[model samples]
Target: MEKITFQLPDDLIAQHPLERRDRCKLLHLDSSSGEMKEHVFADIVNLLRPDDLLVLNDTKVQRARLYGVGGQAGRKVEIFLVDKLKDDEWLCLVRPGKKAHNGDKFYFSAREYCEIISILADGSRRVRFVGAPASEIMEKFGRMPLPPYIKRDDTSVDRKMYQTVYANEGFSIAAPTAGLHFTEELLADIEKTGTEICRIRLDVGRGTFKMIETKTYEKHTMDPEEYWISEESAKQINTAMKKGRRIVAVGSTVTRTLEGCFQSNGEIKASHDETDIFIYPGFQFKVVGAMVTNFHLPESSLLAMVAAFATPEQILTAYNFAVANRYRFYSYGDAMLIS
Candidate 1:
C-alpha cells in the first residue's frame, strides 16, 4: 500500500469536463519497455491494430444520490444508493445515520416514501421505497452520483457528459471514466480500422471508488460489484484471444470484469456474478492485454491496478509528466492508454 501513495496536487484535479469528449490529451505507455508518449484522445484509432479487440463497459449510471427530509425533527439526510437487494429494497449509505433510524421514513415527494428497514453489518442501511418502481422514483428525484472530488454539484451537462456514448443498461452508480473520452464518431473510426468492439456490464459502485486502507496491499479486499458478460460477447472475446489478438479493456472496471471472469483454460465464459477482484503490482494478468483508463486518484485501488498493468515507477513518471504539462486528473479529466 505504501507504493500506492503519491502527492496528488489539488490543482490537477479537473473541476469540469472538457468541451469535446475526444479533445482531451492522452498519455500512452508501453507496458513492456516503460516508454511513454503523448497524444490526443482521438489519436487512439491510429494506435490500435486491426486485429485488436476493444472491450467497453456499457453499464448505464443511475441517479443514485438523493436528498430528503427524514426523522421526527425533519432533518435533511443525504442517501447514496449502493446496490439492490430485492424489489423496492436497496443497500444505501445515509449521512447522519444516528438520526435516520430503523422504521424512520424519508420523503422523496408528497407521494413517495422510503423507510429504513435494518442496518447491515457493513454499516449500510437496508431501505425500502414504498411507492412506484424505485427506478422511476429515482429518475424523477435522484441526482447524479458524482464523485466527491469534483467539488461541484452535478449539472445538466453532467447528465450527458458523465455517461459513455454506448451506455445502455441503467445499473451503475458511477461512470466508467475512461469510456467517457470516446465519442460516437471516435468509436466509429476505431471500428473502421477493423478493431472489433464488444460490451460488458459492471455496475460501478463503491468498490470502484474505495482506496486501500490497510497497511499491506495484499490484505486489502474489494467490495463486490455486479457484472455480466453476454454469451455473444464471451464468444467474441474468447475467439479473439484464441486467435492471438489483443483484448483492450476500455476502463479499469472492464479490466476487473475481464480478469474476474478469466478461466484457467484461457477461455472467457459468459455469466452473471459479483466480483471482489483487486489488481495491484505483482498481480498476474490473464485476459486483458491493454487498457484505456482515466488518470486515477493517488493511492487509489485504480492507481494500483494501473501500476500492475505497467509498473509503479513508470506510471508515477507518467503522472508527474502529465501534471507538469497541465493535463487534468481524475473523473472528468484526461485519458491514458497502457499497452
Candidate 2:
C-alpha cells in the first residue's frame, strides 16, 4: 500500500451547512480510466446506471445537545447525550469535568424537565431523568447537537438543513454526509431508471470525529458504531450480486453497513450489532462495487476507508483536484463518486 497523504486548507472546512442541501459542489471520478470531472450535486443522476443498487442510511438525528448545572447553576455546563442506557438514563459527556465529580446534582428550570444523577469515572455521566423518557425530555429541552466545528449555535434551520431529505428513519447523531447531496427529485429520477434503492441504519459515533493516531493501520483501535441490516435489504443485494449487477453504496456508512453484514459465503446477512471493522489500503471489499462520498478530514479513518475502497493513489489524485478546484470540504460540503 502506498502511504496516504493529502493537503487541504483549514479555511475550506464547512462551518455551516449550505442553504440548499443539494446545492453543494461535486467532484466526480472514474477509477477505471482515472478521469475526473466537476459539477454541482444535481449532476449525480447522470453518473448512475440502471439496476445499480443505491443503499442509503435512513438514520434520524436526535436532539442530543443539552445544557444544565453540574450541581451549581453558576457552573453552567454543556452536555452531549451520546447513547441511551434505559428509559430515563443516558451515557453523556459533560463539560467542565474538573468541577463535576461523582454525585453532582443538576436541576434544570421547571419547564426544562430533566436532571443529572451521577458522573462516571471516564468523565461521562449516567444521567437519570426525573420525569419522562429521555426522548420526551430531549424534545422539550435538547438542542440539535451540531458539531463543534460549525462555530454557531443550533438554530431551527439546522434542525432541517443538517439532515437529508430522506432522513426520517436510524436515530443517528451525525448524518451519513454523502447521502446529504441527494434530493427527492434526484431519488425519484434515479428510481425511475430501474435502479434499486434501499435503506440501512448505522448509528454513527462521536469517535468518528477523531483523526488517525497511528501511521500503521494495524495499530489503531476503531470505535464501534451501531448497525442494523434487515432481511429484505440482504435479499435484494444478494440477488443483484448473483445477477452480476453492481451494488453502489451511497456513502461510506452504507458501505460499512453492507460490508459489516457480509457473510462468509459472499452473501449479505441480516445483522443487528455494533461494528468496529476498520478498512485501510489492501483490504478487499466484499459488497461495494462503486461508492459516493464526500471529501474527508486529513488522516481520518474516513479517508482510509476510501483508500481501502479504491487505490490510495486514485483517492490522492482526486483529492488534489478537489482542493485545486476549491470544492467545499468536510461533512456539509462537496461529494465524490468513485467507480
Tens digit per residue, CA lDDT, model 1, 1-339: 556656678998998999999999999999888888999999999999999999999999999998878777789998889888999999999998887888999898888879999998878899999877789888998898899998989998999999998999958889999999999999999999999999999999887778778888888899888889899999999999889999999999999999988832346778888788889998999889999999998888999999999989989988988888988999989999999
Candidate 1 TM-score to native: 0.97
Provide the RMSD of all predictions against the true structure, rounded to 1 decimal. Answer: 1.3, 1.9
Local distance difference test values of all predictions, in order? 0.89, 0.79
Give the lowest summed-lDDT range of ten residues in model 2.
106-115
Give all TM-scores, in the order shown: 0.97, 0.94
Winning model by TM-score: 1
Best by lDDT: 1
Residue-by-residue lDDT tens digits, candidate 2, 15-51 = 7788777778877777788888887888777778897
Clashes of each: 0, 2
Q: Show model 1 residue runs off by greater than 4 Å.
A: 263-266
TM-score of 2: 0.94
